[model samples]
Every structure is written in C-alpha cells, then in structure tokens.
Target: MQSLDLRRSGAGHAILVRGGRMARLVLSAALLAPLGACGIPYGTGSRVTLSEAPPSAQSTPSEGIMQALTCMRDSHTLNRIRFGIAVHSDGTGKSSYGYEGATGSFLPQGTAAIWASEAVIRAGGLSMNYYELNTERALRQFGGSSLDTALATQQQTRVPNFIISTAFTALDFIGGPSMDIRAGGIGPYYNVRGASLEVSAEMYRPGDRMTMAISSLNRQVFYRDAGIGGGRLFGKGKGELVTGTIGFTDQQRLQEATRDVIALAVADVLASMPVVPDDCRQMVENLKAAHKARVNEDRPQEKPAHGSRARRDDLPAQSPAPRIPAEQGPASGTIANPDKARRNQR
Candidate 1:
C-alpha cells in the first residue's frame, strides 16, 4: 500500500510541473500577439517595412504664402535684407519629456536654427551662410569660389538686417492636470497626461548682437505615462513572477508639433519687421486669426504685437541701409528698386 501511494504522488507532481509550463507558454503567446501586428518578431532577422507618412518635404506652414507672393511679384520684399542665424544655446540640456531607455533630449536646438535659416531661404530672401566655413575656405584655397567669398565676406562683416536666435525656455509636466487610470490587473486601461513646452526667440542686429524684437511660443505636449506602475497584480501561484505591461493610448506627435512651432516663429519674425510686405503681412494676420498665441506673444519691452505689422515708432532711429547703385545690388537676389526698399527700412 505504501509503495502504491508513493508512485501516485510522483505522478501528481509531474502533472503539476507540466501544467505550469503550459500556463507560462499561454501567457507569453497572449503578450507576443500584439507584436505580430506591430512588426517582425524578436530575433527574426527580417527587414521591417514602416508605414508611409504623409509627404511634407520639410515644408513650413508659411511655404504656400511665400510661393504665392514671390512668384507673382518682382521679388520678395525681404529678399534685399540680409538675415543671419546665430547659436546661443542655453537650454539644450534640460529635457521635459522623459522615457527610460531613451537616449537624447526630444527638443533639439540645432533643428530650430536650421529651420529658421531654411524658412528665409525658401522665401526667396537673402541668408548669411555662417556654416560650411571649411568648404568655403577650401574653395577659396583652390581659387574656385573666391569672388563669391569676397562679396559675401563684405556683407557678412557688416550688420545683418536681422539675426534670428531661439532657446527652449520651459518644459512643464502637470500632475494636477495629468490623468492616470487603471483597471483589472491584466485588463487594458486608458491614460491621459498633460505637458507644455515654451520657446522664445529674439532678433538682433548682427554686428553688435543688439536685441531688436522678442517673441515667445508655447505648445501643449501630452504623453501617456508608462509602466505596470506599482499596481496590484492578480495571479494564481503562492510564488508568482512579474514582467512588463501592455497599454492603449495615442502616441504624442512631438516631431510634427516641433515643425509647426518653427514655421510659426519664422512667420512671426517677418511680421515683426519694420517694413513687412503687404502680402506677407496679410498672411501673418490670417495666421493670428486662425491660431492665437502659437505664433508669438508681445511683451512690454518689445515692439508691436508679436505677429502684427512692426511699429515703426518702436524702431530706433538709425541711418538707412546702405544703398548700392541700382545696377549692382547685393551679390545675390538683386533688388529691382533699392531706393524704395531702403525707404521701407530694408
């Protein structure tokens, strides 16, 4: 009787061991099912194809307005004015958005500088080439681009009509406004969170770096906080194992938001100019009508409302931009009537 009981006990222990392995396998399959819809399975070594995104071609919000005015007119009104992009990075190290195992800050200062320059260039305006110095020097050494370099150097050493610079000023994560929800230990939960990013830019007279106009933009960026999040777990074993979590929420569109901010800032700068073209000024007004405060906000110390036509009274009295003879305007983007443009404070 004792021998029979021992054999039965051994058989029961084997069955329990087998059952545990089956339970783990089932759990794993349930977890990995989601990944099948996302992409290749882990360690598959397969080429993964991404869903195509809408084609933007790095186009800015003001791109259409620029194309219309420049194509129809003799020249862009701002083309005669030399613009410079300068770097004064103060807030690159601070990151408002946080993700464990994530590398680098979400807000990059370099992109802002590049976007500002491109916005002017795409508008058929003049931009000072501060970058590619190495290539410029090499070309000059080979006598390939000497004439071009000499002309640019002359204009570059003088004060640019305006210099653009920006910095990320604030990043806020609001626990008061952020929402976090949970359901059954294994059931999916809905989560919503709130965040905001603020950036400010200033225009300077290049030679002395004197501040001309100041404007700021604030954007709301929300992210769903992650993790199983120290929540209670419902399980079967006296000794249970734990791992990761599955969530359902819309991913925050940070890249798209950043692009929009950059576009709006560029438009605001043009709108802040003492002599904005009628067409460009109209566009700025339309933007302000559509989206308030995203463009730029006025401060007590600055000239007119951030996105409105510049206040000529606010402009400091100074000699007008030097007039090159009509036959020879700036080396690039020749002005059809230099005198009129200068009168408008080019």
Candidate 2:
C-alpha cells in the first residue's frame, strides 16, 4: 500500500482556530503581556498535559516511542464510561460529575470541579494510572496483549501508527456527545481556550510499509467568568490543547481510520509471516492495491465531478459496516457502573 505520512500538523491549529477569543486571549496574555500580569492579573484557564516518565527515566528512543504509543493502544472510551459509573450493582457511591452546569454554583469541590472547567483543565493533575485501566480493556478488545509489548517487538513495528490512530478514534468518541457525554455551561462562566491532542500507533511487520494517519483536533474558545465575591469578577481565562495530531478528529472518524490502518497493517504483517495461508496473503495484496487506487484517486488533481449531497451519496461506500458485539459493557454516565462500589470501598 501507499506510505504512511508521519509528518502530521496536530489538531492544535484546528482547536485554536475553533478556540475563538478565549484561546487567543490566553496566548496573548500568557506570552505577550507584561510580567506583572503573568503571575496573577491574567486569568489562566486549565491545561491538561500527558506527563510521560522523565527523559532520563527512559532507556532508549524505543521506550519513549512506546510511551507515546499508548495514545491509541489504550482505550479512552471504556475508561471514561466505566470510571464515570458512581455506584456498584450492590448500590453505593452514587455520586457523579463532568456534566453541564452554569456559574459554577452548587457544584462539588473536587470531582465536581471538572464540570466548570474546559478540556485539559489542569496539566499533570490527572493521573495516568486512573486512565490506564480502561485503556487496558480497550487494548484487549483490539486483540492487543499489552501496550508495552505491542510497542516493542520488531514483529509489530507499526505500533506507533496504530496507537496514534486509536487515540484519535477514542477522542472522536469522547468529544462527540453521540458516543461520549458532551456538557455545556452557563455563559460568562467557563470559556474554552485552545486544545490539541496527538496519538500514534504501529503494527509490527518484517519490513517497510505500514498504514497510519495523523489527525490534529483543536478548538478555540472565549468567555467571561462570573460569580459572587471571589468567584464574581471580570475574570477571563484562556486554555489550549496541544497533544500530537496523528489520528482522526473525533470518534466517527476513528472507526474509519482504525479499520483502514488495520487493513494495511494486517496485509503487511501477513505478507511477512513465515506461517501464513495463501488466501490471507492474497487478501492482503488485494486490499493494499485497492487502498493505493483510492489514494491515487484522492490526489489534488482529481476533483469531484459534482460536489453536492446527492452526488456524494451516489458515490460507492468506502468502508464496511462496523461490528459492535453486545455484552455486559460499562454505561457512559456517572453513577451508572458497578465499579463505583469499588471506589466507595476505597
């Protein structure tokens, strides 16, 4: 198949572009403003930064790459849904957070604090361990044993590509209210600033040629903070999300992106395997050829004969239907999962 484009301009731009005033104000105030304003006068919104182990802590580039690869190998959707559950089947810990609110009134202090916040509210505040559990489950569903091993072994060289791809897939799901929960707040309260996320993954094969796509998701926001006494003021805040952009923008895009990468990665992996069936090998080649053909068609030179809803619908479907199996899955809401009992016990 065609080569993967690893040089992806992260969703930072998109997020910032979408950020509107809140984001621009943050950057301007944070970077350009005088020193006096930097410390206190300038309102700073929340920031979420993925804190990897210290550079000295890692042994090699491979280690660093593996860590980055978790953006996909792990499952974000499962974690958000499962952890969102506040009560156990037995009944306890019925508390929930991360929903819509206004003026930050009547919201709890700790978990409830996130409600009045925007994306990536606090850098290094969120724990990786808390997120790791759900991602582990997500990895298992994708037939991966462990993100660590998946990133290592030369046999699975394309781990980074897949990880990045999966990250975007999960983001789409999380950010898209249709899949995850999307909350809104009262104006003059919490305004989103800028946001960015980059995810990378790979699939191991004997040689070159793996399928991966980089996606950047970004948004810019604007708002005035309002409250009583300490809370009420002409408070303005700015925030930005600047994770890597090597995956889809949202979840719907993720499903399509993952399947495409899997198809390409599987073909390459099977092509290199010593113990493989001829039928599978042929299938791989066939898929690769098809993908290459489609990519060529997408070149800038080729313009659609007609660009309209009717014309677009007339085009052949590019992907197959998704196969979502039914099981006792976690609910995507607070106070919904049985695991909340476990939290209560803690």
Candidate 3:
C-alpha cells in the first residue's frame, strides 16, 4: 500500500475532513485524406477502425495498428492543436480570448494545452460519455461544482465563431490513487493507504461532440487505521478507483486519444489553400509518391531477363519534401475524399 506523510500540515487529515470519496472518470481523433471526408466520430458504443491504406484500400489489421501508433508519436505534428475561448465585452472594448489548459502555474504557456491534447489521443479517442463523466467526477472531488456548472452552461451557449482542435499523443497517461474517508462519526481515521493508482484522459470538442476517449485502470488497495484511545482506531479495508473525461471548446479539442484525427484535419485543410507554402505541399506529395513506389516495388512481379530489363528512366524520380512551418488547426477546405490523405506511411 502507498504511504502518506501526515506529519506535516496534517494534510492527510484535512483531505479526510474535506470529504474525499472514491470515484471514476472516462474521456474520448484525426486525419486529412481527400478522396473522402476525414472526420473521426466517437460514441459510447462505437467501434473504431484504423487503416494502413487510405480508407478505400485494404490493409492487414497489424498494419493499421502500426500506422496509427506511429502517427500519434510525431511531436512536431502535435503542436498544431489549440483550444481557447473568445470573450466579447459590452459596448466599447474589443473581444479577447482565454485559453484552456493554459496557466503560468506549474507549467508554461500552452504546456497544458499541448500535453492534454497529446494525452487524449494516445489514451484513445475522446467521446461524450467519457468527457461528461470525468468532468463531473473531478468537480465533485475537488469542490469545483461552480466551474463544472459554468462549463455546462458554456456548452449550451451558442456563439458564431468557436473552433476547437485536438490530437492524440503519448503523454496523456497518468496513474495514482485517491482516498475519501468519512470521519464525523467514530474517532478520526488514520494511517489509511492505497497502492498503484493510474489515470488516463480523453477530450470532447466544439458543439459538445466527442473528440477522443481514453480509459486506464490500475491496481490499488486501501487500508484504514487500527487501534484505541485518542490514537485508537478501527480499520476497514476497501479498494478505490477513479475514472474521468474532459471536454474542450474552441481551440481546445486536442486530446491524447485524438491527435491523429486533429493532424489529419489540419493537413486536409492546409491542402486546399493557394497560400500554403508550395515547398511543404511538394514535400508531402513527394513522400506520398515515394511510399507508393515502394509499395509497388514490393508487390509480386515477374523477373525480367538482363537483355529486357526496364530502364530506371521509366520510373518517376521522386523529389524530397521541403522543410516548412507546421500548419495549425483545421485547414481551409473540407477534405473531399479521406482515402487519399489516409495513404500508408512507414
């Protein structure tokens, strides 16, 4: 069982007084492909399919899993997801935006936003069921009912210009144990401990739609105090667990379980713009072509005689991708066919 140091500040005792309780939370991805639409929708009872080939092409199950996992690990691609709120003032002033997961405490600007997005996608896809449940659990545990209420209100409040972007990545997983004790009756409870607590996060986006859903469980055991007198105590042993989900509005849609979805969205949007750097587009195109060529080369083909061998000139020489700035958020146009964007990448 995990140990707590209550000697200082009686912190453990205070937590008990604050009314701690065992709870759980759960949360709910990306891509740009142009042969078809590129949005991934998640639900409480949904089954997701991954593909190594564009949606139209068939892939072995293992291939799809590998491709999905690799895409989620790319960090440079991860930075583009963003979340924030646009606030308008009465009469005279201009409108301003405040970011979610943004704070000067414990982390730098955008740190939480970035990490949270990655966490969601990596954990899985964010879904509505997970987001609402997780948020409710957190608020109840931390005495943040007011914030929870405010969030609920915001979901129903309609604003013309609101967008949220999210992605799934590796950092979204965490584990730990939490204990809630009832102490009003029978002397103060002491020496209670838990072991091996773990947590995972998922996120939902604009329109209160699910973005990514992630769930993680860990081993935990709770033990209470045993003794008499002022120091005397009776112990009851029970297990504890927590599950939760988070929702993001505006630019805050990214979650560890949805990074691939976000990236595909951004890539798709950028593909339509005339102003996007040609070099970047060329690079992505080149990558696609090279991948195609590699796939073709690996296919079964009849061996040719030395005298009839085809010249290298028959194959198109692939160009290398040019390095360019990363594109953020959803791109300019709706991706037409997702199959093209879903092309296999090694």
What does the lDDT read for residue 174 in candidate 2? Answer: 20
The model with the greatest lDDT is: 1
Q: What TM-score would every model get versus the actual structure?
A: 0.54, 0.19, 0.21
lDDT of each: 0.61, 0.30, 0.33
Ranking by lDDT: 1, 3, 2
Give the root-mean-square deviation of each candidate in angstroms.
13.9, 31.9, 30.1
lDDT of 2 by residue, 1-346 (tens): 1222222334565566678778778887787666654446333674444468856652221222223223222323212211110110111122334445433322122331122111111110121222224555666567665755663463343222111112221121122112222223212222222212122222222125443222222211122222211222233564443222122222122112332342233223323332323343344445445444554445554333112112212224633444344322322322476577466457
Global Cα lDDT for candidate 1:
0.61
lDDT of 1 by residue, 1-346 (tens): 8999999999999999999999999999999888766765455676667788988775554554455334323445676887777663537355544676444666655546776677667656677755436776665677757667885687557656777776677766654234445464333444567556766777778557677776676677666644443245346765454545655556577645665555566666656665666556566556544454432334233333433534443556544555568634543333666676666565
